[model samples]
Target: MTLNLENEQNHELPSDCEETARQVIRQVLASENCPYEAEVNLTFVDNDEIHRLNREFRQIDRATDVLSFPMTDWESPANYSCLEDDETAAGSFNPETGELLLGDIVISVERANEQAKEYGHSLKREISFLIAHSMLHLLGYDHMVPEEAAVMEQKQEAILQALGITRDPEVRS
Candidate 1:
């Protein structure tokens, strides 16, 4: 559950914001009923970097939002292989780093700022939500179906609430 965050940006954001993001992601992982520890590489980049990545990796021409690169594609439990070593990736545990490989999540800080303004929330909250959402995707959770979407969304809200990240909540005076 260790997050090796590589902040590849010069944009200004609150100090400890990355740690807050790490905490939220860890919270979700701890509550998740799964096996194997996965290492999450969160890269904070600008819009251009994300856009280029979006085009190269996803074959899209635009960078709309967050992108998730899952380690494997075990969509169904019948074909599930969590108990075994993943064929799609290097071993979850790396001796050099002593961390599980959970794939990567690239986020656009520039876009996150715009989203915060559009959504009427602080930038911290918006970025935190995106991190949480991407973490779920890393854990094989998705919102492709209505039922599955509800469960995933519920988990997201619960994590955010658990972190006490709310809209305009009174801070200690």
Candidate 2:
């Protein structure tokens, strides 16, 4: 997997944030049984930037912790079989690198800090949770409905637990 990460915010994230994101992405893809190499773009921005993005894209006035923009529409969440059947599958892969272009994720570092404090967890855990949540979105998962939200939440918690980045104060990453 290849991750293109950029930080536009002044907020200081954990020094190992990139590695944490990569780990979460890998875990999500592996759990989903994705057969192809993948690529993802992740960006860190301040509350103002994310608020603008939310208003522009989602039409929500509030600044969100994270937002995902997926590149493809899937018949089923995390199912790669549709890609094999679609003639446009070639468009989803990078021409030179041959990695599937997953999608983009934008995170608000300011919001993450606030959420971390509110949840009584480390910043690393909060960021990791956001990455995991957004990765699932990139793979076509959503939490708009209660059932879907439960599944997404379960998967996210499982991924974090597997990485040893849990909500418990005893566990730290």
Across residues 1-173, which tens digit of lDDT does each residue of candidate 2 receive? 99999999999989899998999999999988899999999999999999999999999999999999998787889988778865758678888999999999999999999998889888899999999999899899999999999999999999998888888755444
Q: How many clashes does the backbone of model 1 have?
A: 1
Candidate 2 residues lying further than 4 Å off, grouped into runs, are 170-173
lDDT of each: 0.75, 0.91
| Leading candidate by lDDT | 2
lDDT of 2: 0.91
lDDT of 1 by residue, 128-158 (tens): 8888898888777888889988988898899
Residue 40 lDDT (model 1):
81
**Each candidate's TM vs. the true structure?**
0.84, 0.96
RMSD of 1: 3.1
